[model samples]
Target: MIMVFGIGDYGLYEPHEGHFAMVGQEMIFQGNWITPHLNGSPYLNKPPLLYWLIAFSTKVFGAHEFAARLPIGLAGWLGILIAWKWTRQLWGVSASRIAALMLSVTVGWFLFTHQILIDVLLSTLLLASNYFLWRVIYQPQSWVYWWAAYISLGLCLLTKGLIGIVFPLLGFLVLGLVRQDRKLIRRLRLFRGSLLVLALILPWFIAVEQANPGFWHYFVVNEHLDRLLDRRFPPDYEVSQISAFGYLIITALWCFPGILFLPSVLKFTWQEWRQGFRDRASTLERQYSDGILLLAIAAILPVIFFLPFSSRLIYYGIPAIPPYVILFGGWYSRYQTSVSEEQSDQPLAISIKQSYLPANFREKKRNKVVTIYSAIAICLGICFVSTLFFHSLIVQSLPPVINNSDTKLLMFIVPITLGLGWIISGIGIVRQSRFALLPVFLALIVTYISVVQGFIAYQDVRSSKTLIRAADSCLNIDTLWIFEGSREIGTAGAISYYLNQGQNYNAKDIAEHHDTGWEKGNSGRIYRHVMVLSDGGKNRIPPNFPGSPPAYLIDRQQLQSYWNSDRPVVFITDFLRQFNDLDDPENRNLPQGVGKPSLIINNRKLYLNAAAQKFECNF
Candidate 1:
């Protein structure tokens, strides 16, 4: 699945992916490592840590979609490996595999890993940090473990900024408050560890500040504080606390069935945790129980920390995933024990088995029977409806896919058939054994991945790169114009990366991010290639722009410049044109829009040119 499709091949996936690609390409093009400049302006929306990783990858691989996303994909895999190893220590060898599988199937981990985003890397680092911190609490006399926690904390800071460190810090404080792990604090080596973290990140921060004055205020005050406090100038996000239901919904979508096992996780964690405080438990049992308690607290802290924030995206809930999966894996391990005829592996699982074992059929047997059959029924029901009514769903509820790329009947039919086969197999297994639930569940997830990959491939490259492909034809005409038109689905960033493969690619003309409008092209020089959107989805125009600027009026000066060009000046405008022109007419792609000038020149753009500067930017 990893090798099957290109990141840019599936469309830049709109603003988030496009932004990452653009920054990476720019980092390579400019050879400026300290300050990540985009479109000749300091693009400080995010810290340069992720950009540096991408820059290194692009430097080695030459800015391909695969190269841009390779690091995060690797990070995701590393996260799974770490989860597997750590779970083995907390649970057992079998639980380790289950924990790793849980993460692999998580929608958030899978998607974010493949896509070029900071969160995958951030999530991995946080997982490691919290894992080591727990080691610091339970496994004493380990200086290396404390260092690992602090080192990961620093890297996390570089990846997303203050929130990176803030998450672990809050989780630590929460653990200390709840578990009273005070000795762990003394062992943290605070002074040495603080210096180590600062040493790793201080050079980059200093370099950026020296290069761009007032970066501290914009980065710390605006990007960090204002964004979090919902007080940033120009207000990027609305201010309000999220309801508990919102948290539940976000976690449900992210963790899915595993999250549904929360009650079981809480029950097991609570029981083990209570035993740790009792004097009768052995040293090893107390150590294992303490680890579980720490994980539970770590999982809950992020949700509580973000509760007061007025603005939050569902992805921000990523920090909770590692702990939740660990706990879920424990429940699964315990469930396997009660059902299996073999001896349990962990002491806790042994205890659970002792309580669970009964003369006749156990409650777990009844629960397993009900749950597995109910799941099978739901799967069959959804598959039946999808296979039978796919056409109707497309006509009404669903958005149309390009090139008649509709979901095939076989796609639905084969999965449903396999599911029924599993159900039948599961029923047979339940008579003598209940371990079939594990294989059946694995088959379901593998089937899901296969189906998703098939749909992605069927969707094809043209569906995603419409505007970029449209622009591809104009390169022969020598009508060079910096992209001033927005390409939704973030084809713009993909465009910048691909189009800039030429040795003479303009740093100014290709708005690496959103257009700073400081490019020399504003002086009006006619050249080759189509230019569209350095990042201007917010600068939406009519389907027929320049001719009719109903939503966003083009500057008469820029319009005249393009019209008077010696050769045909090709530019695709009217973002709404995609509605009629593209094959996927109904797909309303999401684009990044905040902190940008509208098609009509706003006050900031005016001020930049207010100093008798000639405004010659060709849209």
Candidate 2:
């Protein structure tokens, strides 16, 4: 499946897409593991732990797509196992099983597990820390558990920076305060444990910073603090003006099926609390209560911290999902009543037995029917909401050329999946079987659909090897290859890596003058063969360059004359005169006078390049 998808061929999206892969490749090529580099300069965006893992994996697996993505999938699977183990210890076997099932099948988990991103790895660390902390809190006599907790927390820091440590600590503090577990709070060994975490996390920062000056300032100050507080980070600075309250509201809406059960879970917790914790409850009941409270705190704390931050993305809430699932599982598990209570022996044995006997069959049947109905309604509601959202996304993404029938066919898939889930849940409800099992089935279907969609989208919109192929084609050119226009790093990075084959490549902006030192005598010129890959829109060419009134106005006579010059220039643009001049018949003659046949590839005119000869002959 991984190979079939050509996952290795796909690069990361813009804004940090090439970062991990590029750095990891450099680590392998340079045989240096301490300081990360890109284009032979210090790269300090993230810690080198993930890069190191990727590099090591590439070394073993031969640097393919599966090797890069293998760690994330493994991390996700480990996270599920940890969640299950910890939940079983804290709550019980049933709740732990349900939690594991939910984590394994969630759409977010499924999507991230297959990608070469750090979110899933971060999630695994955070969840592991939470699990270990829970173990320590419950069994405070175990110093080993506390050490394990510190180790996991430190690794989390390595995975995604300070927030990984900060969020879990915040959740623990909140849980302690709410539970008033004074003994647990005082015996936490904060001083020693914190030092251990720091000890584990600090070396990388110190080493990387010493090796590369200003690494701390740029990564810690700019990327971490400034990005959150100022919102002036990469990609774009236009912040979402939504208030903190608005963020909370939107997050609740986005959480979907999980959020739908939040009210019910809270109601159950409140009822348990009002009953008085010390009044009358078994040891099992107390443990369940503690687990629910801890899980709730863990789930809500991260969301609270992220709500105030200026930037908000959905994936920021990934770590919270597991705890939320545990909370839901704990709440549902409590509703089960045992039917094996013994009757008392008395002088009137028959009368005593009758008094202690279970309820009538008809009454039991009624209770079962009611539980079934409630479960069915909840499943139906969730399925309906998910279907609506999926349909909305499909409708918005439909291309203009798609026919009505095609659009309808595409849109119907979501509702069909929804209907199928509803039917399965309804059957479970009627049979009085496990209701939670229905969600597991639904999640499996959702995961399958999401993976399929991701693959299809990758094929349709993503050009896997365009830059690499183009770079490979121009490898032998003696002229300095100048990448003109903006510093969109994805295009620039891919070109640099493939063309230079990990060597440094010189880049100059279109606005900047061509350096005369490199350009002396034709061979000395920095870029003798300029490869312009532009969309060919207006104002794309620099105003400083003296050209024949842009490519649009150049006639065949002018073009021939310009080509005859000693220093030939290639202008790449997507300016298709035929498409642009279609609306104006008077301007139709503009495309006809060139006498140049339009360069076509794969049945489409090359809108990406103006100098067809440079690329056309090579391809």
Candidate 3:
């Protein structure tokens, strides 16, 4: 509930989430459950499962950010719990707890689960589907679990189109190859499961195809195959080509702190290899190792499978973490139990023969714990010092950063608290004091939450929510023709969203708007109530803003000219409130003839070409 309630103040628009919200709002407002649209034009970007969730959420919650993200957040919790249950069954209760916590705190899962992205939802379904499939394979006897696997596969298809099914199929194929079991294929109940999956998934595809003639071609050929093969696609898709290693870097980053356990992994694997695999292990121990191998396959293969592709995103790494967290949790649990015993008499080296790595490299010796805690303390001290003076650092940054005065001493509380907390925790951990460790853990959580808050504040500055709300008083939104280019989509979407009051108007609803962007049109004060353009002298003004030719180049002079006219026109552009006065080094290169804006919105400026009446209607 906390994940999806009262988010009016959290104002920021990411690339995909903006479109998702627009479609959801359109669905609620237009009552069109099929054929989603963006800016009044057909939105062919993705399937509608996520949109359905967002639409329903907005319907109940009144179209707030919380509504936009609640469904995915709920889905994330479901994924975590499923992973926890599976890990517990495979390992133990402690491993399950660690698995849940690890999944929640991993950089990728932590961030993506909170945002309105289909990837996280898809990842959850993927994990669930794979988990059930594993159950059917290893712990099987029940049709119920098989049905669950089939249902998860079908829903996965709904969540992310083809890759949903493709991922599971690939994973199953890998598992069969790893086990050298040719009979695994026949044992999977391919016919029944495939039929069940089709039964669940085909209706939407058939309906959408019938309603829109080319739905299949666009969604499959263009969205999936083209991007998969080319990595880059047409400009309409707005994707850039990425190197094969791009996603690798992202994967490592997403699994942060977890990846930091590599040395531990190497250390433990070496120790295990030195001890050699004994034939005396019990069934439960054998199952644990088997589970780890399967998880290792599931976690690592998706990353490698993506290597041939050109397109990449951090969220694509989401699928890789479930197995990763499970394996990690298993290792941590084992280490906690084993570390109390004698040290291994083996040299530390990466074992090339052992395919698996350990979560904890070495036992948590006293010296090692001290070193780790001491390093953390030093890092926190630096962060604390930086926080004390971070505002001055921000003042010299880009205009998008919020500038804090040297005197808002209250800002120091969070950093100081964190720094001191880290120091205390480090000392406690080094001394192995349980009481000190408790507050230290709490402090770590506080530090994490504080980082989230800091991220929000940093991103909030770049948000044009303030500018859009302020400009709300000066424009006739019902008839406004805001000009926005590719780079300006964030601001454009925000302005359009505010103007419509969280209602999504289709891209083709131009009778009430025009965002034709700066393509080659001329302007000579012909616009009626108000106009908002974003380039703001950054680019040569298009001769025609919403149309072609007959447009004057909009610069400081042209904006000021319109602002001074008796028949006033309001022009909105992002600007620094005190551009020349800012401590920013970029101010040294300010345009020679830049003039003042008529209205200042926080730090972003607005130049108004005012008419006798400005903002005749309230937003």
Candidate 4:
């Protein structure tokens, strides 16, 4: 419920969400599911799993935000359930519940639920693959689970390309080498498994390749290899990647308060290590140790894979989160019902075998539990006080675009809610109460939901939905929508999506043309390639796609020509730089023919040509 709550309350987020949603919407518009299209051009960057799901959802739920986001939400919910079931098998019910909640409220998981990104879905499929692989390791005779593992892996490939196969294979390789266990690899039936994977994924690849030639080169070399080396064309996302230290910071934030319990887990690990060397471990002990090792490797391997690459995004480590939370759940549950004496003397596997807490476990484990609870409480308290005092500085330090009252309010509320919850849980822990950690879990859920609400409040600036709708109202079949500025893909996509409802375009008519020299005609100079599909080599009066007439990124010459022309033209400017122009009189580059904007909303200015005044418009 929390994952899907109010997903449709705000418009799709600019760029990423808007980009995917537009592609999915276009799939339905074009009646083409095999090849994803954007602005009437083939978008070969990502696989069709997310687009296919969104297109399916849009069909069932209508073309809206709810439909676009529902698929990711369901994926996230399934991820939580998978974590719960896997943890229950490794640990017990209490641990499984804890693991599920931890995975649910983590910053990355929670944020991605509301936003339409493939990372959450990709991580979930990978986690499912790992879970099935775990089952195969324990029950090698169960060939059904083995096939299931390969099937999940194939789905992962469809979700994000090769990483689906690469990530899991890497984890399995590291696991086999660490444990020197060849039996698991032998039992994997490599020949059969490879065929199974290929069978699942090859049909779509072949079909898409046949539909669009040169897809194999672009999808594999440019998208994957060049992307890994930071040399992909378009060079759009390089700025979003972070440093090694930033990757660590992102992972920590994604894991959040659970990461703070690392010291306790480390102490337990040290104790287990000493116990393993001192005595001949039982079979159960060995299995428990193997499970722990597997989880650890699975959690860290994705980071290790992407760490050396410069093209790693903050969410690149999302696949690492599931195993980390499960590991935390396993150890925390052990401590919760641990024996009275020092944990160092006892094998950690004993706790894993136990199904319920002993009657006399409470008073003995109180001190350790209280210590963990109090330490977290103190940390939350410090964060709360710091936020109260330093919030102004924090907001001032943020980029001017997102430094709004909504973000400020979020800063104040999140820490306070967390600090208060931990304080209450701390008191309960001291009292030897059952379910002391419940408050902390509830608090996290509340904090993330609050975070989403805050983003919705600031959506006017972050999204161009309102502005697009305003422009759509004034636009008609004859009015041409022209997007100005280089990085307005989100606004362009939104205009194409919301305005072009029930409209159709012939894909064969679209042509990609780039302007090389200065303009000698009314066909304005395009900054790059004009994305709009033209009519019979006529770039001046382009054909409409779905909502309105063709929209293109036009240079100053084209702006002047369109402004002076008799045809109705609606110009959408980039938010930040265009707004900056309004502030600086000398730098303002408005053409003499085009006067003041007809509408200005959320820093996005909409300029209308003389012929557009026929329709009454307000901003």
Query: Which candidate gets the maximum lDDT versus the true structure?
Result: 4
lDDT of 2 by residue, 1-619 (tens): 3212334545443223344655665576566688765433445666777888877876787645556656676787887887787666644666567677666666566666656668778878887887777667657789898998899999988887877788778777876776677776666677888899889978888887777666677777766887678543342323234566776765554344456557766776555433225556444444445555666666777677778776765566667777777666655544432222111211111121121222322235557534655576556746654676567567667653342454555456556565566556555544545563565356446545544554444431232234344534543333233332222323333333444333332443322533311211112112222233232223222211111221222333443443343332332222212343444332222222233433332212222223334544444
Model 4 C-alpha lDDT per residue in residues 303-395, reported as the tens digit of each score: 888888888888898888888888787667766654533243343454434333323326465555466666777667666756778778887
Give a tens-digit lDDT track for model 3, residues 295-324.
666677778877876565546777887778
* Model 4 per-residue lDDT at 94: 67
Residue 360 lDDT in candidate 2: 27
Clashes of each: 12, 7, 26, 3
RMSD for all candidates, in order, please: 8.9, 10.1, 8.7, 7.4
Instruction: For each candidate, give its TM-score against the true structure.
Output: 0.76, 0.70, 0.73, 0.83
Better of 2 and 3 by lDDT: 3
In order of lDDT, best first, we have: 4, 3, 1, 2
Please say which candidate is ahead in TM-score: 2 or 3. Answer: 3
